[model samples]
Target: MEKKDGSIDRKYIPILVLLFMGAFIDGLDTTIVNVALPTMAMDFDVSMSNSTWIILGYVLGLAALLIPAGKACKNGRVKKFFIAGTLTLLIGSVVCGFSKEYAFMVVFRTVQGIGAAMMSAAMPSIIVRLLPPDKKGIGMAAMGGASGVALILGPTLGGFVVGVASWNWIFFINIPFGIVLVLLAMHCLPKDGVPDPSKDPTPLGAVSVFLTVGLLLVILQNYGDKDQGVELMIACSAGALVSLIVLIYSIKHDRERAIISTKMVLNRDYILLGSAFFLSTMMLTGTQYVMPYWLQISYGMSTMESGMFLTISSVAMLTIVFWVGKLVDRRGGRSSSIAAQLCRLVLCIVMIVITPPDGLLILAAAMVFLGFSQAFSGTGHTTRMIHHATPGYEDESTNFLLVINYAAAAMGAVVYSMIIAITLPETTLLEIADYTVRMTNDAVNFTAVAGIAFLVLALVLSILVPNRVPDKSGKASEASDAPDNASE
Candidate 1:
């Protein structure tokens, strides 16, 4: 339903529910499988290395398809894709639950990942394309909150499922729940746009993107492994470079139909926003990778206790996203984004200074601020990108955003791991059983200092972000004008 004063109409509630569920399921699968990995490994008689492929398989499949799927959301039949994605995930999950072989389990997980890619690519773009300017923030907040909830609940739910039944139930649980959501989505989702053949992304463009992402992920994941051959890394690096070149050619050949649009690639504000987003994601992943080790080592806390403490951060994020949505609506994306970076700046400083035990309260405060930073920056950058996107290309812009997020996650973990490895070659973070509290603080401080450098760069970029892009006539346009009535 359309409203007069920018408030959500009653008719839109079903759509929001579907979006939230889609995001929640996609995110839930990411973490829920972790708790089941040991059980899965035992059941399948596989080594830990082999079991890791289950996670890697899904990530590779999801990351490779995200960009192509984003284009499909705009130029292809979206409703059909959404249904197909859900059904695909359902089938994969059921098969995964019933699998007698480890290889089959990994293959089906990849299938589930592809399905997730379709849903994730379409969901955020739906908010931008389908909702009004004032209402888009609310939709984004709902979607973001779903992710936060998934993060908090996934492991706990996984543990409970494994405790009571076979680990396969984790996948089995999605069956009934997914089916209901799919039916609801079919009824509530907006009608799909007509397929535009002329705007179809080229096969070469899709292949290039797939190869580039897949190779990059592989390289990042295997970078420091002694078992991984240098020749393999070199080959993958070359393949990625070639794929990037092909992508550049495809974009130049057909900017309108390329996986990534030329207008977005060339836009200064888009680049700045993207860079800031990438850096922020890196900061988050780096922190996540290191924090658990620091907590258990320095605080003398058990794994469970450390996990429970970390949950507070997600709780903070989940709580603030609801409020940040309204704040973005009132203050605008640029202002909110700048505030987000400032929050990150403070978080980094706090992490640098706060010691464990005595500074536990300060550390908790920093974690809360970290959540606030994430909510503001994540939502603000998204809205800003929507605002500055070229007219008729808002959906296409989301492809770039999702691609950057995937790349940053992979890169962040590897980059920070490398930094730590280089700094303390004598002992790894996990092997620091004999480390003093002071040594642990030094390590965390080192990471925090690195985080500060990145955050500073992001802050500068956030400051440079403009409100909107100018049209051919040199007049600036409102983001709402881009696809204001496209959904209708």
Candidate 2:
């Protein structure tokens, strides 16, 4: 149960496979669900505004719960958490496949998010603990590569399913994947990294969850189809404000048990990289959120066609990230990250200038470059974050990535929803297909502005990061007394 001569302990390869599966499914779910939204809307008899909750709800559930569950990950329950999570996700997927009502789908998606949070909270820590320093970069990259594959194939795969089968297959497809992962977890996984059970979760943390959810709800409700939800928006805003006050009080008085670890937040590496990640999420994943709708609604593209086009970008992303991860290992994350940001900054400019009227090839070129930019930046940042993880705080470090990533996602959904709702506030999307081209351009223009703002901020913060992994005297979080890494 330790690192061998120049590779991972062979006994633990099964565990690594399970961990990779976990990463793939979690990442797959994030991107795949977006492609099916239009079909789901028709099947469930809901408006475009309501259909979007399928996306927002999953991000919300994951964002709100990851904080508490993150700390709880140190509670010696890794296997149980992972098993329960996969099972819950399996059940939720099956249920989602059979969702007869919009309410049922939203609820199941939320359930899936919760399960994903559990799996995500545990996987990185395990990966970190198991690998030697030399491979951590590759391990992170490999895990990321799995997600990148999911990102690359998600829309296309989901679209294919929607085209060939029903959208229900999107969820149902996870069934066999989940079954194998669960069996492997039951058999070969080791109970290493036993967490301190005494570190009980505090109620103060729960309040922050409520506050986070309320804020997201307000954002969604305000931008919702004009037919309904204004009253609910006001109520959520009030509730969020009240919770914010209570959360501040709790932070001041019981700082030790606050929802987020103030110490972890203050960690210099965490701050720099976390800020960069937030901005990237808004720009990268935000585009993932809106582009499908934009394609279908504006260009009258079929779900399958949109998915194929989007796959171009994701393919670019996967290739760059895989290669750049090696570059991060050889050089460092900061340099790789800054370069990626510059690439994206230029892409934003192109978006602002090119406009959809420039035609499909032009747009497709921009998408490919955007994916390349993400691969470089996202891969480096993740390696840097994992490189900086302090023992006893690994879970927090991992959770920091998930929180900002999903929080930005939830925020992006709200912002994009607002953009679409404001520009084309019609209660019906049926006619949006024939809506004026100028309106679509206006929305894309505004989106470019938002992208520019977030990307600029990301570059500024990323520049301040150290050009190399910060020095940590401790060796790898090995499973047992192990030798220094020889793989390098």
Top candidate when judged by TM-score against the true structure: 2
Give the clash count for model 2. Answer: 2
lDDT by residue for model 2 (386-468), tens: 65555466667777777887888877766766766776676335433344656666666677688889888988888776655
**Per-residue lDDT of model 1, residues 1-488, tens digit only:** 33668566887788788888887887678656754654666677653333456666676667778777878777756777778888888888888888888888878888998887787777766776666655676777777788778766765676577766777878876677689878987887778868988877788898897788777766765555555689999999999999999988998997777777777677777888989988877787667655655776688765445555666667778888878776655445776677777777777798877777768778888778877776887676777776666666667776667767756755665566555545553333232445567766676787778888887898889787755432323233433323331122
Which residue pairs of candidate 1 clash?
none
lDDT of 2: 0.71
Q: Roughly what TM-score does model 1 have, to 2 decimal places?
A: 0.82
Candidate 2 lands at a TM-score of 0.88
Global CA lDDT of candidate 1, please? 0.71
Q: What Cα-based lDDT does every candidate model obtain?
A: 0.71, 0.71
Runs in model 1 with CA error above 4 Å?
A: 1-7, 31-57, 92-109, 158-176, 296-303, 354-358, 424-446, 468-488
Candidate 1: residue 64 lDDT (0-100): 74
Clashes of 1: 0
Q: Each prediction's Cα RMSD?
A: 5.3, 4.6
